[model samples]
Target: MPEITVVKVERVAGEQGQAGRVVHIERPEEWAACPECGVISTSVRQRRTTRPRDLPYGEEALHVRWHKRQFACKEALCSRKAFTESVAEIPPRARVTGRLCRAAARRVASGASVAAACREYRLGWPLTHRHFTALADAVLAEPEPVEVLGIDETRRGRARWRKNADGSWDKLERFETNFVDLSGTGGLLGQAAGRTGSAVEGWLDARGQAWKSAVQVVAIDPATCYRTAIRRALPHATIVVDHFHLIALANKAVTAVRQRVTRDQRGRRGRSVDPEWANRRRLLRARENLSQRAFTTMWNALIDHEPTGQILTAWIAKEDLRSLLACARQQQPRSVISHRLFRFFSWCAGSDIPELISLAETIEQWWPETLAFITTGITNARTEGTNRLIKDAARVAFGFRNLANQRRRVRLACTHQTINPAA
Candidate 1:
């Protein structure tokens, strides 16, 4: 009760009430100056009583009866005659104490839902959310310049469609590009509206030239739009094509080749009984992850069922690409990267499969960025992880209709330490 400064516990009841405490709260010999003319009046006006909301300190909510003074201005020239005493802790016309509001906001800032906080603190959703946004704004700073920035796009929400003049529906903006500080804290740095070059460029432009200049390298998937964006925005920064996306591309090519081979050889789509379809998942697994028994089983099945050997060749090509990517974790091996690249290219050339050839050409097109990956070893793996965090927040919230609020919540959660939600 002394925490309020102006108030003291006058008495306490022996019995517990439904509202918990029934302690009499008042300030002894309290003095409050007039807010209008800053004059203290000795005259006592009629007493005004009010019940202020406080933080929930126990299983039940506390019934706080705040007894404070109201002063009548003595100055004749003052426009305002009377005013009640107010402190920074409890502003005038405020129902809830400042500390109580902060506690409620902190509950939501720590990842609890607004409804949960409302239930616990007996606060309305608007009050809790407003306090939370204020707290977040007070603590969260602009993202600092990053050495390695990871760029990737996450879906904003479910796609929206509108019927066109031709009666076909088209998707509205569905993605937001996420910028992450890969080298700093592996937390999300910021985001932009869409995934286009302009969106990326606009975000980078807003960061200013000095911040852009500080970015030495950027890690991203092999998307031409993103590549073009980075070139225009941060031309000096090296763009490292993430190995995960490259490997995924290779695996997709393998799937394509397998389906084509099955269609041509068997004159139908792959069935569950077919060895190629049965061992489909095994084809994507890294050789190190597969036991010798499983490896030999799949190898034999491919040999017997895939007589043209295109599917097998495609699988080998994917493995070679994986091995090439794995070079980042080791020193220059006896089997050099050039040697690995040569073998992958040679396999793709000799296979005579259009899928394999297309994969090889794509790899060739991205060879420079691929080399950038080998040298700097930067990857958007952290960005992808952050994307999952973003998606989880959205999923928990049942998807945000407002992008600003979505960014505010996610940015606060990502930037602040799990413990500190208040300044």
Candidate 2:
């Protein structure tokens, strides 16, 4: 066994009190190889000295006090040249210990900002940022491809930002649009238009066709852009208009019909339909606040209206919602339910509700994708959740001054760490 020896340890002097001193090393004859020759030369030659780094331990800064000597290559035609050998415990180019690098890597990977990480590690910000970028590049170079995407949009920067009298402007504020792949629960995908077809297409282009092909379905709102993007990129993928958004559309249609009925009454010669019908519309408008009995009374009042005008249109929306619910419950392929909705849209054209006509026209224009919902029930839940986390990250960082850094921070926040610092 080799006997252990104590080498000198010293305090490092620098700009800040945060730094520690460097230590000097003393090694036995067997501890080194010849720097100028290929052999492990034990014989001493006239030597030159150099200092290099060693592994760090807490506050102690470690360094190797190197005694460099030239060595002869023995072969006459070898054209032997002198070479210098580095110590085994440290890398030739690095000043910090491997342990310190690992620690910095872990901190940055865990979402610490580069400046904060540098302060914590007693290192320069540039070093921290470099290591952080290396880690991110590694992580993003390989990603698990996702299928079954959920598309949505968020607002980026509000309408109300302005610069002061000085050249500096107030920070840009943004809201998120989330797109998630339901199968993997991966973090948000598209940041472009958030849930629209354009956004989906952008994300698909980023993911590549192999990944897009794996996407069996895309759950989205009734946004035409989303439909167009899906057809363009993932041609075979199913499209599901989210049930929640569909329900909201139904409610909106009902509201429109109610307004039309009131307008029609005003145009008539002062003879109006029963006041109770309008009351029922109010009850429906305030549906979330009404009691069960009130709801029942509203429904009964609508039933008595016997299918005409505003009441009739509202009924159509109600029935349409019901049909959608039933179809969703049936758990058929999204394509099947989509076809049924197309037929329903056609049927709506014959009805008194003018809103239905517009809705139908829009749906018909995107009918191919609209009918895709029956096969795929995916939605943007994962994307939305990830977006919330991203916003929280931005908030904690006081909003990034640079967009590139902001994007990098988003990636760090969203990605799960697979590499271990302890390793």
Candidate 3:
């Protein structure tokens, strides 16, 4: 058994049929200073004992009996009062040792709920929560400067509703914008209430000039809200539209065109029997990933059986967009990508599909941002991963109705720090 400072340890009789140990600890110094005065005094005023919880001893609980003393101030003009002694192992007015408190906090930081950590450590909820908060505060105070930042929003829960004058409820988006440092520690920088320009801008603005100037690039979805905020908060930083988001938009367009064609031709929603409906997933899969036979079968069904070629045209446009994205990923020369983009736009214009046309216009609108992504090869992948962790922590806590607590826990989790004293 390792020795504990200022304490004498011994085996004690079990309580309630449980094994336990008792520690007798006392202040080692014979003299103390009066807190309010600059005088060092040796006059003993009073003595008392306190039993505070300590770290567990194996399967047994350990309790420390601290023999404390108070000394009176000897300064003649002192505001005359006596103060109790304090030790480094335990804070004043605390019922548990510092190590014990840290242990409880570590559990919470490692994904245990506050309630569960309290129960596991045989401590109260309030004390455990305080320790957890302190640990999070220490970690968040010195965030590393970000060079490449990623901004995105995660759905916190279902939309909130408020009753209107007509007794109807209006739904509002329930989201939290997460700012992540992709080029630094890969930890989340901050979270805001909504996915709005003001919410994001406010968080960035609060970071001050130094942090904003350190940012060289930002990866984000093609949302005007985020674009506005990034422009205002970090005007000099280049913006890269996330490749995954752009591909997802193209996929959505393809699905819409398929559904529209299905309805127009059959005069009803697609059923399981419809070949296009049944192989819908195959249609969305990347062309390179599809097997030769499967690809031929799908194309034959779309071309021969389908009366209108709208779905086929839409599929071709979707493939062309995917090829463009793939070309970007390959880091091909700018001229090569430019040639591909030209061909993509020409195809979209000739297809005459409204969905493809709209997609082309959106691509044109964000063309510079897309090129930035191709050149930099930076994406919001890290931000998406961090969001997953935040969501997992929330799920473990059974939903953080209190945003403050949620943010603290997320900080601790992302930094990979244990609340435990052993850590």
List model 1 lDDT by residue over 3-67, tens digit each. 45444443344345443553345555456777767887766675766787887666544577767
- Identify the leading candidate in terms of TM-score: 1
In Å, residue 402's CA in model 1 sits off its true spot by 2.3
lDDT of 3 by residue, 1-423 (tens): 122345677777777877677888787778877767868888888898999887776767777788888888778888867777776666678787888888888788778899999888899988899988887787666566789989999988667799999999988768889888888674887788888999988988887889789999999989988898899889999999998888888888889998999888889999988878877888888889999998998888888768778887878888887778776578788788988898889998998889999999999999989889888888889888988998888888888777788888886776644333465
lDDT of 2 by residue, 1-423 (tens): 122234675666645556666545444444344443445444443465565433345654444465444444443444544434344444444566555655776687786766677777677777767777777677654346766777666554443467889877775445444556577735544355334556556767887778777877777777776678778998787777765565566666766766666557555332245653456445345344668887677667666753565555655555664465456458866676766675576667777467877656655565554445533445555666666767777776666666666666676677554766674
Give one clash count per candidate, in the order shown: 0, 24, 2
* lDDT by candidate, in order shown: 0.83, 0.60, 0.83
Q: What is the model-wide C-alpha lDDT for candidate 3? A: 0.83
Question: Which pairs clash inside model 1?
Answer: none
C-alpha RMSD by candidate, in order: 3.1, 8.8, 3.7
Clash count, candidate 3: 2
User: In model 1, what lDDT does residue 1 have?
Assistant: 40
Error of 3 at 14 (Å): 3.7
Candidates sorted by TM-score, descending order?
1, 3, 2
